[model samples]
Target: MPSNIPFRPFHRPAPDISATRKPDGSLIVRSNIPLGNYEANIGAYWRAAADRFPDRAFLVKCSPDDTWPELSYRTASEQSDRISSYLLSRGYGPDKSIMILSSNSFAHATLMMGAVQVGIPVTQLSPSYSLVGNDFTKLKYAVELTEPGMIFAEDGNTYAAAFESLDLSDKDVVTISGKDHGGIRFDDLLGPVDSVSVEAAFSAVTGESLAKILFTSGSTGMPKAVPNTHEMLCAAQKTLEHVSESLDAVNDPTRVLDWLPWHHTYGGNVNFFGIARVCGTLFMDDGKPTPGLFGRTIENLKRISPSRFSTVPAAYSYLADQMEEDEELGHAFFKNVKICQYGGAALSQEMFERMQQLAIKYIGMRIPFGTGWGATETTGTGTAVHWDSEKVGLIGVPTPGITVKILPVGEKLEIRIKGPNVHAGYYKRPDLTAQYFDEEGYYCIGDAVKWVDPDYPEKGMIFDGRVAEDFKLANGTWVSTGSLRLSLIDALDPLARDVVIAGHDRDEVGILVLLTEAMQKKYADQPGALSADGRRIVAPALIEAVQEKISRYNQGNPSPSRRVGRALILAEPLSVDKNEITDKQYINQGAVLSNRADLVALLFADDGSGGVIKLNKNNAMKGDKDVRNEQADTA
Candidate 1:
């Protein structure tokens, strides 16, 4: 018999909200929580913090050469002032701005802060467009769209091939690496500090001032530039502060170890701006949550324990496993961590439970786990489950000065938001911007969220998949892909890494599961089931695990649309080159469905000696590789 699990105590106060029924039967929910009195721009706080805590470490970088280089607040401030003055002298401002084509570093932070602090809009292009893409098509498009005055990269030599054919006649190109790739040195940007002009420029900045222009992934179509203003970035943080009692932690500089790219909105506004808000000590992490680089992240966590933590769900999954294995890391991670946060995607229920159990074991109490929801147009975080809860995928109420309107679209509740934190519009695309907003001015975010409790709205909302991603079954029964995906992951536990929902217009739902490392290890010698290649593997054990779980789930729910009829453990993993996955490890549903339509057919087909396993209450014909023999052998 299982013991009763106590409610994990989560006590951050809920934001004030009011829900009104619209004339068209839609619901408009608004939060009355008051925002903090933030400065005119994000950099103002940085400037003040430097003055107050002059010698405190601002940005620390741990390089491959075993060099841990750091810049104090005072030094960073002075350098930024010099850089700002030089940019001003060279006539760089809102219209004539700078574009950074480098990965995140100490220089990237200062340059971005210096330019944006003094009203020079900065456009940081994603390194993927240059480094990862085969043709550099997106980079070419971005350059043509922005037509920036200056372009800066960490090393000119590294980006030589990317910038070679690009037209940079009127543009100033600068690099920190001094490799002499027909560009000015980063040191050249450090000139005499004209305090009078710099101060005036900072003071003159307003909410309307353009701080940055970030491009979308361009997976669906040509990328659209989202213009984020100072008000948008600053107001976003203020609203975030309202929902979170953790603002108390903001008074003391936050110690963070993060790797989210500066080009991404979550990295720039939520992670980066959140640190700068309190003059936090940021240890720039060089590794990601992916297979090869996560070791670097583990090494960092083994040493520098953060006061608070923010990372994607995939990273947390990897970290949670490491913590269980490494006792020293487990203790250090929970020692000073007040809040553990995740974004980009929903945290799996197993991962959420794993972290809480580890926290209880290590810290004697559960550390608060938070997941925020928003988009590029929202300037970063919007709804945050600021409370301490073990529950996954619950995106809480709107932050202060923001309203969320939920309209019924087909079978899902479409969530829309409007507030100070919201972006003004897409850059140079007034027509597209106009179409995205409703008459009431709420930006249609295309997400579907259902309230956790119908009677009590303060509890929070559960994200049902994206409206655009959802498709109706043959019998017209709508499947909530996001909700169902979470259920499958939970039921399958460690076996299901990430799943793509199949049977869009079919009789029943199916799944394409990306197997876990543990699963891969278990079947290392099995030739037919598991392969050595990291990309794709067909595993009978994978199908066996999923079938048992789905059967258990079907006995409870008894809904055809919610059932996982068949499953295929692919021999190949989703590739970034194929545009199947995002930087945050989120699978692009459309891209996957479009690229691998053949694999999807095998799930529904009668005969699949081809690795697809039929596992359903509804009659999906059993393949020769049925788990009856495989299951007994494993047992």
Candidate 2:
């Protein structure tokens, strides 16, 4: 931790300013912003909003015919109350947990609200997690940590297959929705219940009561369950509302179309609750943001034309490609969009510029775009760029009531945050929880970052890279793998899917690249692409293009550390089965390195030795042999 950092308490005013009163008799402080203590609980906010907009559309699901099925706030509240009563009748109340295994849907949110209202913690798991070969491991982890009283499955087949090996007989109830099964239906959970009992249940819940337990993606290790309290949710909602107001967003009934997985915090806490605070109607798009499912997303966008949009950077890249091909569809898609928020992964400069160009070309103006930085432990959003401008990499100022302490780790600062929005530590994992925070009670974010404007001081920061992902070259020069990976993609735009950085403790940085099938086919047909050694050789021209791009990137950087000294274009792509990729399609560096140990060794082969890369003995260059030997020794 950084030494002698100024200490500031949550309700204390800074020494620089004084408190004042607004004309409406509300206390206004000049320096210290009030820590968000608005509603007593998360359900209170929803109830207040429902009371204010009882007849307004709260949520909508797009149908196959391109029409919407709307649910009113009053109706949703009433149904939520019924569900709460039903849950209480089933002997599930405060201190009990219910796990939701589903995607984004109106019913998901309703069930979550009911659980929150009755003070029952709801833990949501990704529907795609069922596809993982070790699905039982993840399911068991959730069950062990949360100890859920009931399990609600979105679809019967998926639920059955996911939990077939688990001993869920001890669970009080197993409910299924979206499809009928032999088990209890979710619709059956709602029956005639007295209003007085429902109101009493809601009133009994408090701000400090636990609301949800969200698990990590488990891309690196076993998933950690993070408990979110009602206070934390209410605080996050206020922070989002404040940031939205700062960006001049109108608190009206905005339209939103999002396909982000409900299991993730970005989809559950930020998008869902953020929209609800404004009485917005959320339209669930049943499509992933990957290339395979992007067509469905585009189809939905063309039909809905949502006023506000959110997506990952890869999704935006795909949309940009589609727009480049058809301008008409781009125009229709972004016609009503006010702000487009991108998160989940770093936004590539190339993709950002493409989005800007396409938005201006089609929408008559540069669309307001923003990026957010946070994790599930932070309740989705801790920092976000204001959407008044189209800044590419800036993760804006800290939200109200949140404090960011950048602890210097070598040259970069690892981000740490402290606020009410932070989770109540990992569930039943005190050792893990103890490792995540500093002595000052700040939750270490694990990401390294740098200030965009060090002189200005309040301009916020930009992501540097992940501390664990960065490695050293042979000369001990540190390489930012995340930044280098983005640079590689920018350099090989429209050709590469992803690149893995190699050469830790080696002479120089090397890369293993996965090219797009189109580019792979183009090179496969080119003459002289096949080598005598039986290895599929990359075209010299294509390699030269990549080299030139790297040279350009090196020219823009302050140090030669960002440059890759060598690269090998791989014929095969990383596979999930090999543990080289996550379910969300993110590269797993350690797994990739372990799985491709031989390929990495081959990149540093010596002259005619190690049975790896064969050298031309007859025409062996003098200095080249020594260089190859040195590289091999380093590898």
Candidate 3:
């Protein structure tokens, strides 16, 4: 637990919730607070924001030389109106959707709003689909599913190969720069506005009207297109607003620096529209949480001290590593930030304490660190941690206008959500739509949760691991991979970036560890750092450290379900093309395991190959005499 330092105050609404036990022992949770009237159309909020804060900067981005170029609300409105007119003149309507292949940018923001306001559904695909791989399989899948009438990319020359691979003969290609393949310049879209036509289209928009089509990360299989209606997006923002009363929003200086890709729900629906709903400024961060790219995020944080910092847990780990060594960066990041939030994965308790300690040291009070639970199927977040707390891993309670049902599944309680913010169905995939929902119309989210306090249901729920990720050993002992992964991450701390649990049908558990960049760099100069084949890192100290940590963990958790019996260090990076990793840096456990079945086999082979570390039945350290530097294939 963190020290007794007082938490910084934010006007967050208290958790007002109630629960009812069903006849079958299922628990239904609902928020007592009512969700008042909200905008039925997303465009209406844009108009209201533009009218109120016309001169205020709504979107900001970094130039090559580190200058911030901003787009004011009024300017964005005028340009979007022009874009709406141009789109309408070209006969693009609800069915003739546009596909955006670019990342988060001011231009992308304006174009999305422009098209959606006038009834043209826009599809945002991960740039990794186009730029990261040679096959472009996911990109082709998305194009075939959406059958878009137009495509937009930031640079035509950069994405020319991707466009060439796709059959875009009848589709229009729009680009901001590099006029390759006879593409239409994005600036050309800014034409004269037809107010009467635009007004008619805007007025015709309803809650059921399609606004955007977002694709899943394709971790399980081919990406499924999720339809975002005007009602879903608007109501989600309203629920978010009612949950967290931002001081920044009230003071008129709410600024956010974010790098989560706009293709995902967290970035696309929440951060993008949620910021706009509050009339706040979003500084589009181009940096990612990778080794060579995270420095750009640090530089952005140094320049723009935002009021709120929301990102994934992996990014927070990188930020913690940076802030621990760099005092100036820590001071700058904690200067104006009121709340720190995370989602997409569980944050380790060690990380939460470290961040709160840093906040107390620099800011005189601990800034409230929070998290929420949601998915692409749900508009954004159905439940959130809205109160001040010193603990981590609590997903809070149901937000207004949402209901969560907790049904017992084996030893875990599976969570299902029903709300106005939930999407109707997947685009053009009736089979998938029918398969995911229950007879009661609640979407089965496949996640498990437990009440913080069974007696006091208002305390919210703690995230138990994913129901599908859990697997039983050969002995029939079920292992909760979600909780186990977090435990391994906390145990490995600065050495391992992530660990994928192997051994589903085996007698015991094993882990494939992805080493942190610092760990690799720190041991690169040491003797015996590289394996005999120069494929894996076999530093004696690194291996010894890992063995000792896992040994201690094994001692602490002796059960077969929790104890790790063997471990292997993986050298290859997770591939975006293979769906092993998302753009937000979240590892897809199923994808990684299936994609690297050889590694999983090597982990359980017991031959001591590939620098495999093993522990005796009594949790004693196994001698490393046979732990050889076995060469393995890389993805």
Candidate 4:
């Protein structure tokens, strides 16, 4: 094992900070920062970077429709000027909002910059929100919520139904094809570029101007539109530049192949802006992490050696699995990979270790795997682990110009942030915004963190869990769902794709697990626990696997809140349509528990109708499957 107990020796210099307790028993940490503030505006930064690296390729996309279509920094900036001109000629001003209903594309990026350049807020919807579901409930709600003056989709035909669903009498549609939905061509929209009008609008852009508005993953109720100001986006990027010296995404000319959607803050504010800020090249990979599209991601990886790259843990898990098997891909992946970042979910320790081993095997050294803790409200990456750590899930200290205050909440320390990167308010909801800030004006992000070592504040804090995701047992012990869920996934790897911790207001914790596709394939021939025709799975192996893992965990942890009394393998996968999972694959803890209240009850049922395996209270005892089997016989 690596001798560094909590953290490995960082490849880069990590920031050091000191924490002192306040009168309210809250801990406040500030970076030992020397760099002062700058003019916080992306428009100015883009203009400067274009002048610095005029010929550098800014956005790269392999086109099946045409030859190599690479947009340079100079070209993109000039086209965005045209885009600004188009927006003005049509009477779209700084106050009006224009929404994009498409994935990341060259056209999408140009138009987005165009809108934001002229002080218009751009809202991009997750394609799945509109295209995946039959009802288009979330899409309609989002459109109604933003009350956008203009809607732009790349292919009008793809979003035809969405246009019909919306009452677009007052709204104008911008599309390339000009689908019979009554709109002008996106190309035609750019032709009326009045220099006077465009320049006047550009000059009015400020740090406080609204840049974009993103919707939250609607796990609880209807999705709330998060308004991201230029200050938030600019400040977040500047924080990134301050902490990690090597990652001058604003100045460094790096290559990144990413598929993270621009609608989300991570991709938009971080990856998208990271490339745009420094005049780096971003190759938009049109592949997802699903079994079907994962090959495309690997293919993209083989083609480019990215200096920095990131995604959700699920994608990393998939890539790690492929790397272990494919030697050529593994070498190519880590050859130039100086930094590997993960966000969206708590990466399991198992994944962290597996990727480390793969890295060591291929490159003779391990790359620093970093992640940050923030939300859409923080405009993504408020406090990130800029340096290498031996482990995953270290949210690290506050980034430069950001202050992280840890307040005592019951037994846990709730994390809050006061920074320029923090969003001003939610769209059209002053009532909600008033409730969001604490007495100190720090945004209450609903997340909690624990000190890895109280003595060494600079070692950074690990993610404790989400405050909203935690619940109390019937006996009143708080269950930290985030930590426990990650523990279970680690203990039962290659079996559980995702897990939900249930049993709120109940005697003990229960686990709801979604199985990996590999398990079914591995046990296909045997008298496995799958239902007839392989449609449903009641995997006996998985039950035993989880029971063993939970029993072992309880033995080490010895806390009622930590002990899992029962577990069930759910055949049904978590749905993006229902907002159970975000596009980045982070689970909606509230949504899953609320949506599956019946299953939670089933887990505790004395009748055992839920396929739950009951473990004995004594930690060492083997799990009993008899309760479920006997109930089955009786039924």
Candidate 5:
């Protein structure tokens, strides 16, 4: 019998203005005065840091040899000033935007600071978006939104091609990072500059002035350009500071090894600015946290023991695999980590358990892992769990100075937030701006959330799912895809990469799952083993195991809406080229459903092979040899 799970409500007292200790032992409090609006100009902070901690190491760049390059606050500020002067001299300052296309590097930070110093807004676009054969639509939307005065490419060849492809020739200046690119050399922009003049320019900037125009992933249409000001940026930093303070452990002078792309808010606003605000040394890893580049992250981890670690769930899943194989590497990777933060997607319980086990075995302490809920428009973190003091899936209390309201939406509640960190509006997108915020000025988060202990008033709430992503069965049973996906992943974590929940307007929910390559290889040679296909044929034993897991999950849920009636294992992983996934690796359900319409149709199709097998009309199947060849080609 399914359990009768009771609905619980969560309430909280008004945020205390007094400073609080975060679970990690950092002090945080809401500022009495509003952070002065400077329209996203980060240069003032840079100047302040330079003045106060001139010799303190500000940024570090990691190289393959383990030799980390360090730059002091003073030197970085001076270099940024020179770059600002160069940009201003070339007719790019205040109101004139520059588009930065690069990964996370010291050069990227310097260019970003330089733009802010001269009062010019700099918008960083994801380097992943610029990949060959991947969708460049988002990049185009960004280009159109910013109408940049200059395009700064990390390298002369790769990023320069992206700039040219966007047809940004009208821009007055084009600068490349390294020499050898047939463009203006980066060194030329570092000539002597009047420090006084740069300071004056930065002073002229205000928090309300436009700082950056960030484009949302246009999964639906053209990406909306959300404008962020200095005030907004500072508010985000303050929010993070408050959360850290509540945890009480972020102020310690520690090193952070980050590989999240600078283009995303988690990287740009939270990880990067949050680190700077706390005056910590940030080591930029050139490699991403993806399977292809995660080796670099491990290599970096071996060299530096970061106090705080932030990564997406996918990366953690991969790391969990490595940890199982090499205890020594796992210990080194998590040696100094006090807080391990996960976001961007839901974390599976399997992955979560593995993390806890690794922390216990290696670090000897239960390093609290946290997750948060926010978006690019929110500047990074609006609601986050206190690492040292929360259960999994609880997106903790609202940050200081932020107001959250759960607005009723039929049977569910939509999460909404109102705060200084909330974006002023979308750039030249008044329609979207009006639609995104309610009359009360709360930004509609589009996520559904519920209180696990509503009457308790202090225990915070748990994330439900995306309201927009939920759909109803023909019998009127609404299935929360986000919730179902989370539950499924939680049940099969460390083995599955992601799963797509289907059966909307059907009798019951179904699933299309993609297992990690490691797991696929593990069962490759087993009897009745599945071959890689959109419809992989798995062994009855493994199928039963998965079914039992699903059954176990359903046993604790309230209704059949949370249950999976059947599942189809996909042999192939969804790729970015297909638009079935986002840069952050979140599966786009609508896109995936549309792309796999045929497979889905087959799931409901009448066939002679026990409601599972349908004749391959397209001749997609061959033999193991051909499938292996295709896999090799993909790799």
Candidate 6:
């Protein structure tokens, strides 16, 4: 009943893994493939890429007028050398870190490469911390913690408020524009090039040298500074290249057009550094997955057909909807894309099917959808789903250099990672470092997984849920929040953007859902239907649709731990400043629950108010005052 369209030529060896069981019911899984030799520093890869393809475009900036400015590998290397010489002349080193507060840009990349190549740790903070809120709390916190010697901003005038709020008396403020605000011009740094000094500093860079300090998403709390060493960054990409047979294919440079923020691990360490490793060209995408900005991404796609397309699950949902409607966009998307990759969350079966159908329609073949499982602490990715497959939630086997330890914890197997790529510890926070790593030096990542096939170990693992996120109801029935969340998303496809499960220590589970753009548009005609942010439901018809859908979902998942008893469409979007959402668009379940405790209380109260949609055992949607009153009296 399914189309037997073969996948495009994607060559990667089959998973070769072995496992060792411990006395405490913990299993250590590893790949038989070796990591082999890798570059000493991430900057070395950039140098090699320049040597391989001197005049090839290393980075391309998309423009509205089709004047896409490109920087060649040789030009980038030379400019980076000049920047490195400048930093060296100023006596910048490990202690004098460079902090960048701008979004992804050519100057940002060049500055990062220039600094990291010479052992000066560079910290790239999310622009949201500075530009999103008026308070600038997170920005101040990062400034206080990192204690950077120099701070870089794309525009000093745009971040004038952010700069005024911080103590920059002793720090150097550099900007590409808006120098009137007491900022140093970025162009002035290119006056001289100390070639001998630059070479000596670069040569002294060892595997232990700190290349970058990437901040964690701060989902649960304040962001932790994770120091990434040269070994970690270089080793991660090397393992992927060593294992993925087609990575360095002859005459095929890895070309990717991406918009993932460079502040995050997926964008910075993986995409940026990995592309440089294989002499690849990275087209800088100025757009994002959000509503107003996605048009830019589509425009960029129209001009440059990337070899690999990768993004978050939310972005895929948006793209799939757009491609289904716009034939030209679909054609442009699948024009030369060899693989479509997703991370952050699991893709729904419906979304996956729609993409494959679009691929079949446009490209005559199903492009392989690849995903991996890892975090900032693991450098980038520890496990990868490299093979061609349609199945979602398959995180695949451990990569060549990494080992995954699955330890039994209460009915779930918690995943811990260990490898050369893994971070030694948090930056200057030995307390947090000691708390995360175990006796065997494995970083306890706190994620849970299960075997896809116990008999066949190489079949890979499925994400169960976060071990810390799982909680018990009043009757002590444990709930796997991760699995339940994914199932609920699938059950409410085309309607729910994301669902956060709430019912810790309560009688039953309830879901706080963020509605999709399409769902909001469908109910836009009704007066008082949507909030100003277009997230809430004031219209009765929209509320009823959600109630009916979840009732059907509860029909199939009748178990206490699986079934959601009530639903509430969120009125307010997740707050980035409050740590409710990550830069990669991942909803922090714990942060949401903690910040919106009042909403959780209302979901549990269920006195038929606040647009809470409840369902009874008779499969009846109950929002009527009489029904709720009677139920409340009985309780």
Q: What is the C-alpha RMSD of each candidate to the true structure, in Å?
A: 3.2, 8.4, 2.4, 3.2, 7.5, 3.3
Off by over 4 Å in 5: 1-41, 52-56, 134-136, 177-182, 245-252, 524-541, 554-558, 608-635
User: Candidate 5's residue-wise lDDT over 1-635, tens digit each?
Assistant: 11132111112223333334446432232323333333246555667667867888888888887477799988888888888888777777766888877677667788888887667888887676575554476677677767887766767666655655667457644455443334566677798896777767777877786777776766776667778788888778766665563332235575788876777787787877776666678888766656567878877887777877887778887777888898777878777676777887766766766777777677555666677788888898777665344357667656666667675686776778778889867888788888988877878869888765755534566788788889999899888776678778887665677788888798767788777656766655564465434246455445545555665655666366876655656755576666677677767888888889977875655442221322122312213243334344333
Each model's lDDT: 0.78, 0.68, 0.85, 0.77, 0.68, 0.85
* TM-score: the better of candidates 1 and 3: 3
In candidate 3, stretches whose alpha carbon ends up further than 4 angstroms from where it belongs are 180-183, 246-252, 524-527, 532-535, 628-635
Q: Between candidates 5 and 6, which one is better according to lDDT?
A: 6
- Structural similarity to truth (TM-score) of each candidate: 0.93, 0.83, 0.96, 0.92, 0.85, 0.95
Q: After superposition on all CA atoms, how large is the RMSD of candidate 2? A: 8.4
- The number of clashing residue pairs in model 5 is 31
**Comparison by lDDT, 3 against 4, better one:** 3
The best candidate by TM-score is 3
Please give, for residues 76-136, the per-residue lDDT of candidate 3 as tens digits.
9998899999999999999899999988887898899899998899999888888977888
Q: Give the alpha carbon lDDT tens digit for every residue of 457-530 in model 4.
A: 88888898888778899999989887888888887776666688897898888888766555544543355454
RMSD after Cα superposition, model 1: 3.2
**Candidate 2 TM-score over all chains jointly:** 0.83
The window of 10 residues in a row where model 4 has the poorest summed lDDT is 1-10
Better of 3 and 4 by TM-score: 3
- Tens-digit lDDT track for model 1 on 299-414? 88767888778887767767877788889999989878878888777888788788878887887776777887898899886787876564778988887778889889988999
Scored against the true structure, residue 94 in model 5 reaches a CA lDDT of 65
The digit string of per-residue lDDT tens for model 2 on 464-516 reads 77888788877878888876787787777766656788878987677776665
What is candidate 6's lDDT per residue for 253-299, written digit by digit as tens? 77898888899999998999878877888888888876568888888
Instruction: Give the lDDT of residue 601 in candidate 5.
Output: 73
